[model samples]
Target: MGARLDGTVAVVTGASSGIGEATARALAGEGAHVALLARRRERLEALAGELGDGSSVHEVDVADAEAVARAIADVVARHGRLDVLVNNAGYGSMTPATGSALSEWRTMVDVNVNGVLGTTHAALDHLRRAATGERGIADVVTVSSVAGRKVSGPAVNVYAATKHAVGAFSEALRQELGTDHVRVGLVEPGLVRSELTEGQGAAQQAEAEQELGLMEPSDIADAIVYMVTRPRRTAVNEILVRPTEQAR
Candidate 1:
């Protein structure tokens, strides 16, 4: 039998590293042609090389609305159809609001909130069109955080706010797109060892150091693949994945 996503095309933002990279690889494994989107051209090129002919790289900053729109248009123009979009590009700066630089807060809002908004908006029409085609459905999966569900601590003040914004946006999008057969879902992870958590001093790492073992990017990737591969009648709207030991 053919793979579940054979003949489909998928776009994964922030594909240069971490969860985004893993998701791109996972989607390609399911036979979807993957479009790798990120700011680091060299990293994207390396990934594209690894994924071979099934993947293409686009150097883009998701926070830039125009660039994001162009990238999506390029993907559709090249592939003729778009089936999945993984909004995984994000920025995190964990510090008390009083001590944090205003620039850091602005960046968090741009990449975390604005990025999701622009990418989703650019792809909505195509996703809706794809829903009416052969596969009968399309998917929009945004990688959020456990902070999105609840504020874990003071250090995550603005970061938590951005995630909360994404959660609200995803829910509204889900309600609007369900009837169109375009599934909108959010994957809220607790602590994953990635660029965002490794050296960045993200609050999640401190939580992990307290004996809450971290999850790998692939774990979240698996959840995403599962969400999009379900039978057409199923719509996995929101999945919150935390480490087995993470309490809050």
Candidate 2:
């Protein structure tokens, strides 16, 4: 309930819905001015409206490197600094290797891997600069998944690979930025009730629900808030959260 982020500026990618949307709201609630970025203009606008005065909305596809850089620059130009960056934008498809189209794999790599790179690269300077301010810290929280830690199943082959890549990327960034007080962290979440999971068939959905109890977006949002709100000297490197009933 503490306003640890009061007067800070936070940018959350994939903010149109689910974890991204919830994270944006949570950051704003903690008194951070939030910039919401997503491909869906309507959803971003609606969320911005709901967050009231300290929120700005931008429609952007994270996979577009140039566009992402420009958007991040614009946010810094307007807010003067970016204290937090949440790379929550990602895509997934559950197709086996044998029958899967290369296009699906490419999409996952582009959005899940390259998207994180693009957004993080653009925000790095801003985050580092923010760290030198009164708070003495800045944060980069990337929303990975359980898949990043392990291959849950065959259907998640390429998806898992993409997440794993980002995991490595996060660790490297953490090491490099630690000295600068820019805390780089990763959040790996298990099955959640979102647009991605809702696409599964009824049987799959029910099975997931029965096993994992279906996490709400707010669950992941809370984790993000915890990571960013840590004391200036403490950097929460990683968090892997799963449903109580989920074993894998």
Candidate 3:
């Protein structure tokens, strides 16, 4: 038998690293032709090579609306259909509002909130069109943070706000697209080990490893795979994943 996603095409933003990279790999494993999108060209090229001829790379910053739209269009033109879209590109810098840089706040809103909006908007027509195809359904999965659900700690003011905005958008989009056979979902991860966390020095990293037992990018990737692979009649709309020891 063929793989579950055989002949489907998937576009993953932030595909150069972390959860995005892992999701690209996982989706490809299930037989989707993956389109890798990120600002890093070399990393995306390397990943595309590993994913083989079925995959392609498009280096575009998610913060640029026009660029994202053009990239998505290119993916469709090359692949003939778009079955899945992973809005995984994001930015975050945790600092208390009193001392936080205004630019940092704007960056979070641009990449986290606006990026999701632009990419989803660009893919909407294609996704709905794909739903009318042989598979009979299409998917949109956004990578969010536990911060999106609640403000768990200090220094997360603007970051949390941005995440919350996407959470709201995902819900509204889910409702709006259900009748179109487009499944919209969000995967909220809590404290995963990725580029964001690797910035902590070795000493701090070791301490965090001992304390939280950080989840790997593949863990979240598995959740995404599960969401998109569900039968057309079923939809797994939201999944919140946290490390076993993570309390918040």
Candidate 4:
């Protein structure tokens, strides 16, 4: 039998590392032609080499709306259609509001909030087209965080707010696109060993790692692959994965 995502074209933002990197690999394993998108050219090229053919790389800053639109167009133009878009590019600054640099807050909003918007908006029409075609469905999976569901801590103020914004956006898209056969979903992860978490102080990072036994990026990638590969009639809307030991 053919693979689950056979003949599909998938675009994954932030594909240079972590969840996005793992997700791109997982989707490709399912026979999807994965388009790797990230600002890091060298890293994207290296990963593209590892992925071999049926993989393409696009150097993009998701915060740039025009660039995202062009990238989506390029993907569809190169491939026949676009079946999946993993909106995974994000920035995190878990600093208290009082101590948070205004620049950090703004940058978080740009990459975390605006980035999702730009990519999703740019791909909506293409996804809808694919859904109505032979694939019978298309997927938009945004990498959110446990903070999206609830404020994880005091310092995650703006970070939490940005996550919350995406969560609400996904819900609205799900409602608006269900009839179109375009699935919109969110994956909320907690305390994974990622660039985002590594930003925490060294001692605190070690403590969190020791206490929670943090999840691997591949775990979240597995959830995403599962979400998009479900039967056409089944829509896995939201997945919140946390370390087994992580508590509120």
Question: Better model by TM-score, 1 or 4?
Answer: 4
lDDT of 4 by residue, 1-248 (tens): 98999999999999999999999999999999999999999999999998889999899999999998999999999997999999999998777788668999999999999999999999999999999998799999999999998986798899999999999999999999999999999999988888877877788889998988889999999999999999999999999999999996
Best by lDDT: 3
C-alpha lDDT score of every prediction, in listed order: 0.93, 0.94, 0.95, 0.94
Deviating ranges (above 4 Å) for candidate 3: none
The digit string of per-residue lDDT tens for model 3 on 1-248 reads 99999999999999999999999999999999999999999999999999999999999999999999999999999999999999999898877888788999999999999999999999999999999998999999999999999999888899899999999999999999999999999999998888888776678778889999899999999999999999999999999999999888
Error of 2 at 208 (Å): 1.2
Q: Candidate 1, residues 113-133: lDDT per residue as tens digits?
A: 999999999999999999999
For candidate 2, the TM-score is 0.98
**Lowest summed lDDT over 10 consecutive residues: which window, candidate 1?**
200-209
Off by over 4 Å in 2: none
User: Any idea how many clashes model 3 has?
Assistant: 0
Every model's TM-score? 0.97, 0.98, 0.98, 0.98
In model 4, the Cα lDDT at residue 17 comes to: 95
Query: Candidate 3, which ten residues in sequence have the lowest lDDT sum?
Result: 197-206
